[model samples]
Target: MRVSVVINPKAGSVNPGLIEEKIRSALFRCDLVFSKAKTLEEMDQFLCEELAHKTDFFLICGGDGTVNTCLQYLVRAEEDLTKIPPIAVVRSGTANDLAHEIGISRRIDQAVRNILEGSVRNIDIIQISSGDKKAFMLTNGGLGIPAMTADLANQVRFSLQKVANCPQTAGFFKSIAKNSYQLIKKIGPGVYSLMVAEALRTWDPNGWELEFELPGDKKFATNAPIVLVNNQPSIGNKFLPAPFTSNTDGTVNLLLAEGRRVREHLSSFLHLRNGTVSQSDRFTSYEITEFKVRSKNPSRPITFFGDGEILFKDVAELSVKCLHKGLPVVVGSPAWEK
Candidate 1:
């Protein structure tokens, strides 16, 4: 097999030396072309120039962002999907959301073994376009509270990193802290009320206007405080905002929280993990193949984030469509095989 390996040495606080050793041992009997990319630009260049053609497979050793970056560039490099190589991800980042959803192992040895022995499965990719920019999302994307929380979490992460002096360690603790806080806030006594009060006091409920077309071409409009479009089940590590979501299903799940007041917003926030928010009168959920979103006022731009990174901001309009079974990925256990 002609395999191309891309490793992000800075991912998930993994020891670069140890990962390198594992990679060497795993591919000892195969033809290997390896490169380490510490930044997105390097990964882009490598995909466009070196790994664009004639590669049988791509082994990505990093987290969601690293994997997203490689896939984005690969999709851009070859307009022909058949020319792109099947990818296997080694879960080496904080919040390996995509890896976990696809049943990829976090342990390096097991992941390597899976890469060598696994079967390929076709997976769906969310193609997003905003004005002149285009990108692809492998996990979840959202505006409103989801975007707010992401921005807040990044600030907290960077602040903690400044004190810890290690990005991986900071991220580890950040995940723990963020998850714990969310759990407590959701289940603690009076915490739900406190959250609602705080949200009412601080949050701008109708920051944007959302217009979407359902699967049957039915048009709907709403003033949503938050709109989350999911291709996977979870958001952060533990938040299963859309439990029914599947990346290979040729559809995306949209969760719209239509709560404008304290009581309505509180209900939406409280039911986020259980996905019962969809049952709420103020919430709307849909499984659709394509949709469009835009800010209410063109001058007042909004940001939508996906796969733990900001995809686009300061754009008046955006659109997302699922390219059903558009990318081939190697998995330890194929869901369809069952």
Candidate 2:
């Protein structure tokens, strides 16, 4: 009983031979394998040498930055502690939202026959930082203005956010207008926080100056621009924002838009097409494990991202926590979410 599949096959409508012909017809004896990461340093050496522990399971298709690059080598080998494995997914690229919140299967032979009829679950990960150079170990990280629209939707890789369901205006305003001239030839000073969050429409955007601390000592600013630091629930599940974010919740919710509930998340676009965007106010909501992101206008630092990819800027500080280091997901028994 062995299984290993990490085929990205350049994602986006991937067809690595139709996920190797339906995981070779739903593993009649299992032991099927595939790994074609194609650089994130060869998927960090096929996820730390032969899919770490020669695959008991490791299936992933792309998007959510290749599931945060295979959870940054399985969460830094458990923060350099090691010995951890269990992950499965297939919802190929373009905002699958952790495979629709760990349910997997946008249909690759029914997510590989529910991983040849599965068993396993323990999910929750989100750790980013600026102190020791760890910026994105994600399930979607964040910073104000949807962390600069996930760094302008990772510089235009086939715009219109590869097919958006409004994922923050097609993944952050069409990745800052289809990669603003190749991100101004590579981060030439975050094009002034991408032109002050596009002429102050607000992503907590307008005119720099940042300072934040939460999880208990609550202090803040994005110069009174509404806020949003969520880890997942689809930033474009029509802005479900942090709608009770939980993968087993260690905690990192914080959705503050403040005062008049930041005018109900800046008039939350009249509840975008019915996803209900949790109708902003009471400065959103807050739950935490750790936090801090500072900016006193040190040239518009205040940058960080994961699901959208950025990572950093002139930023002086950044941190997020909650790492119950989990993986190994597949749950479908009500005759499969019928």
Instruction: Report every candidate's CA lDDT.
Output: 0.73, 0.60
Which one wins on lDDT?
A: 1
The RMSD of every model to the true structure, in order and in angstroms, is: 5.9, 17.3
- Write candidate 2's Cα lDDT for 1-338 as tens digits: 67767777755656678778877887657776577866688777767775446566677766676777777667666654234556667776655666666666566777767765756677666667787777544455555655655555455443433433245565566566545434442443233334334423545344556677886687866554445556555543344656567766766675654433444544543442244556544344677877876777766666666665676665677777766635546654334542
lDDT at position 153, candidate 1 = 50
Q: Which stretches of candidate 1 lie over 4 Å from their true place?
A: 158-202, 213-217, 334-338
Roughly what TM-score does model 2 have, to 2 decimal places? 0.32
